[model samples]
Target: MSDKKYLVTGANSKLGKLVISFLLNEYQIKPSQLIATSRNPATLQSLADQGIETRAADYANKDSMVQAFKGVENLLLISMDAVGKRDELHTNAVQAAEEAGVKFIAYTSMPNPDASPVFFAFEHEATEKAIAQSRIPAWKILRNNWYFENLIDFYANVLHTKAWLTASGEGRHAQISRTDLALAAAAALVNSESGKETITLNGPESLTTSEMATLINQVLDISINVVHLSEEALEEQLESFQVPADAIIFATTMDRHLKENKSDGTSEAFEVLTGKKPQLFADWLQENKQSLKAISNA
Candidate 1:
């Protein structure tokens, strides 16, 4: 058993769970050395059953965070699910970790947090700043790109309407898989050599919105068209889809950033950290083709 203890906040979340699974299954880290935390401990019963410590650590509850971090040597502060309350919640987590004397903190942040037009980037930047001022011995910031899972949100529309809409305006994205990012986080946490680092995790290749749509169609054996709209038009279209107004605003803002080429870059950071190339979009689509069919049929 490793002497160090790891606490993963939001351990029940999709990315968080993947990170925990990778840490245990891939790295061969002992269950006793890991602590999985969620707002509801019931959601993490499996981890508890496996001999991993589980705790109900709500970001809004400082005392719960404090208790969760007690004796923890490293912390993986997965960003909170609650969108608006992220800054406050993250701040509380940092404070608790500092209070607990955690030696290192690995934060899941977003791409180009300092200049990202994405509203969520602001929260990540704030969290990074908080971690910097917390007096922790070490910190690693994983600025992840858009997850491949996000493609599913537009999958149905692309299948049915044979069209994909975007405000990106031909801008490219170096999309990376959530699993890949999770694995990188696990490797960084487990490796004592990482020290304090800020890594931008991205896919091996960058592709434009239209190019991505083409790849998806090719992999699914379907025909689809890419529709690029101005930011204003995209907002109106999103509203028509019943997307919340604030969400539309945020999406448009991110689109503007993409248009300015703020999110595009070929980074080997993922491979460097995990010692393997990040999975490509077409390959992921081919692997999950059946699931896409099921969702489209349903």
Candidate 2:
């Protein structure tokens, strides 16, 4: 582990930032042992100030990845935030990693990427295939489920209006915190035991839309009713809020998939890897109450 070099792409992203922090502060890893790359290296000045290597690596540009990944023994290819171009970008990154002599690659992927009913699964599935074909010495696929933080907006809006709107019906999701997922990735990268394995990192418990609302109410001392809207109504509401067309379509489609139980999965995998139980939604909300309260008041 001492001899291996680690690189994390999308270093400016939430998961990437958290992973780097976990490795450096929690694991007491040296700054020289890690490399952080983003499309704009300027965004990573803080990491650079900490003595970590910061470089420019855009997933869409193979040359950038090749340069950023040079001598990197283990690489964490975070799935790009771009929706439509992910497959091409991921392929380019994997190819560049192969060219740069990266011995192992870890990919952040969605739950059941190959067969997920959700609209976002195709690109993840494609990225996984590319990694397999890259033929790096070893690889690990981290199929992370939804983040509990995703509901912050919903909770904020609900606290403001006393109503939580959703098209997802009673579908339940075992969503983990972004911090927990980051810790798990860091655990995998630092430990020598992880290789050629695929693990689903999920929250300790699953909760439905109404159940989640209840949890929020419990923590924040606010009661919000879950209003189940039809798909058309949900779309109309999102459009009224000026959400982009693509995002509206994706959210509605995911709601349909949720109704079919697409995300109803949970595991102890995170605990196994990090030696700590994943944060429960209620617990996370409690820890983050001040921010949520501020948002609610705003």
TM-score of each: 0.95, 0.93
Instruction: Give the top-scoring candidate (TM-score).
Output: 1
lDDT of 1 by residue, 49-152 (tens): 99999988988999988888999998899998668878888999999999988999999988888897887778899898999888898989888888888767
lDDT of each: 0.85, 0.85
Q: In model 1, which range of ten residues has the least summed lDDT?
A: 151-160
Worst 10 residues of 2 by lDDT: 151-160
lDDT of 2 by residue, 184-282 (tens): 888887763556888898898888888988988889888788889998999999899998888787778877766766667776778888899998899
